[model samples]
Target: MSGPGPARPRLLGCDFSSTPSRRKPIVLAWGRCEGNTVMLEALERFPTLSAWTGRLAQVPAWIGGFDFPFGLPREFVIAQGWPLDWAGCMATYTALGRAELRERFVAFCAARPVGGKFAHRAADRPAGSSPSMKWVNPPVAWMMHAGVPGLLAAGAWLPGQGGVVGAPRVALEAYPGLVARDLLGARSYKSDERAKQTPQRQAARVELLHRLGAGEGRLGLRLQAPDALGQVFVDDASGDALDAALCLMLAAWGEARAESEGPGFGLPARMDPLEGWIVGA
Candidate 1:
């Protein structure tokens, strides 16, 4: 309920999109420790950056993992003549409307050949994401635009990205799938379809929990259909919800680390407000 502690910081892992207008806003699943067990709360859906952030400010956490770029590739920001610093870069990007930003980003990619178009941050090279602000694959550039400024506005640590100094809110970039893959391999855990959230994925999740050392039994985490918001589906699967659920898992991990490791757990290496990082346990 308070700061990140051995009591388990509240975590929210997010799988963001370049645009959330048509999609299920921003999928959010929150996690915290219930006594000695790590469990998830009911999924909360937010319609915009404002709503998402308002919830975060109210919910005290050591840090939460957001699946978005921490910074834009220095090359891209430089090429575009945008601000060089994290805070400044966010200002420049967020000033533009979605249409304007998209057109400009697309133009940047159009000028370059197939593989030559987008810029890649140093972290993207290791993370295996394209540098360009393309909409598909990993639309990190767009994610940066939508996700970063919100955190900055909330006065969160952003880590590699300089945050509003002395803000109590702290957030680390995180990708739950990365950690899930480590624990569950390529096994698909959640589905967008009412039918696909089957025994198989449930079993997979149960097994995944065990791998995370939660062997006693089911805790607070359980995958269920979102009651209010329209569900998001990919290839006939409810991946959006699952992805949001995964974000919650990542938050739990970040909470654990920040409590044990201090502020270092929330800071980043390169400090990109545009290109985000993924925190691991």
Candidate 2:
């Protein structure tokens, strides 16, 4: 409709599978929001960790709102003596393989029995979720570990990189659901049930489109389907289909927030990823 308005830079949301094994590899979904409606698109199906990284080399240069953490838990870093900063820690993660990484994280959690299992971000106290090495939901921390390097290698910039105000460059470190929970109130719109994919789920999905600010004349935009690109939106009959749709809700919510809020959707200098935040709070 609007042919890519200035207010809305491309928003990308991904639901990564922590254990990207062949039996259940990582799932990557990308999407964008136009006003109240979100255009859902599926990126790739990585059956292996190596193939996943290998394919990430193809992500286009757009302001991405990835569902991965770009930072590490301050507590975990100090306790494990892992590199404390992004650049250094990435190098460390890159050096270690899956077996060693898991073993090390297990030991770290083992040391702290009660709450030791969860590491603390620098902003755990007042704000919340200062990007810790999380391994759940999407195991975003590892996603960051595996994903960010590719973005860097791709020569894209971070969220706050390059003093550009509204540049169409890459800005990683976005949690899409960071906004959806607020609008939907934990309403499970997505499920793995074929029967559950009844009118109810379809309706819920439609409703989400509106809350995301999508409409014919809302954001001055249109979702064009490029014939050359296929399978960008996976309609898996399993729970995976719903999961892919959930990623769209995330993208729409994120786009809405970025349109309203400043600097897109980012935590204050005091948020903690472990405790998590209230989405649009």
Candidate 3:
């Protein structure tokens, strides 16, 4: 019998925590695709940013979907008189201390009227993502402040940011809630609060997994999970595991598109470089 050929390239999706610790870690859901099927191979947990960044720097030849904004809204960037170019903006952004960043953002939000305090990126409209500058009630702004620079330092090529030539790793912005909503129709799946981890959400998780395995979504990609791995997804009350799986599927979808449609990982032609697009939205 012929020996197995080289292993298929893998794809990854990460559910990140801005403040990670032993109790709450950055979770990576990784897998490979075979035709229309995505096999969720493993879950990696990094309890600190250093550990996570090390993985990002060393890992090669994979497409990853991460749950953090790749860029802030162009309008917001412009208003702050920051660099118009993605690269410059990133450089300027990553240089600031978190306290200064937070103070600036808070002041910006406070000056605006109610119901219009936060500026939105173009991708936010379709993806239904929160404004990347919002510091409260999800605090995705901090996530971006903490996450994107690490990705760049790791030498991961961002599609909208002139894409590093010949770089093996491609990073795309992802939001698991977007995919979850597409499948389960606004049913809540995971919650950080112990009080909110209801049975309803648990059932929703199982149902979503079953639907994904059956290839019942926009990408038409099936999920393959053995019983042991499947239980791992269900048992996590915080939903980090489930979110990572959803992101992994999105990465697989983008990979399939890259093969058929010639790179860009299926992102739109007119996407804003200053405000990166979410992979599937």
Candidate 1's residue-wise lDDT over 1-281, tens digit each?
Answer: 67765443466667666556544577776656543444555566677778877877776554566777676667767778997876787788878887887787788778778967777665555444345365556666678777777787676876655786545666766666665666676798776468777767777765655454443322233333233321332222445655665566556555555566766663454445555555652
Lowest lDDT sum, 10 consecutive residues, model 3, at 160-169
Question: Tens-digit lDDT track for model 2 on 57-176?
Answer: 454434454545556666776776876555666677767776777777778887777955777654333323333555554355666667656556645555432223354555445443
Candidate ranking under TM-score, highest first, comes to 3, 1, 2
Give stretches of model 2 more than 4 Å off: 1-11, 18-60, 113-116, 122-138, 160-168, 191-206, 213-281
* Candidate 2 displacement at residue 3 in angstroms: 18
Using lDDT as the measure, name the better of candidate 2 and candidate 3.
Answer: 3
Computed on alpha carbons, the lDDT of every model, listed in order, comes to 0.62, 0.51, 0.86
Q: Judged by lDDT, which candidate is best?
A: 3
Against the true structure, candidate 2 reaches a TM-score of 0.60
Q: Any idea what lDDT model 3 has?
A: 0.86
**Per-model TM-score versus the true fold:** 0.71, 0.60, 0.95
Residue ranges of candidate 1 with Cα displaced over 4 Å: 1-9, 17-23, 33-37, 128-132, 137-139, 184-236, 266-276
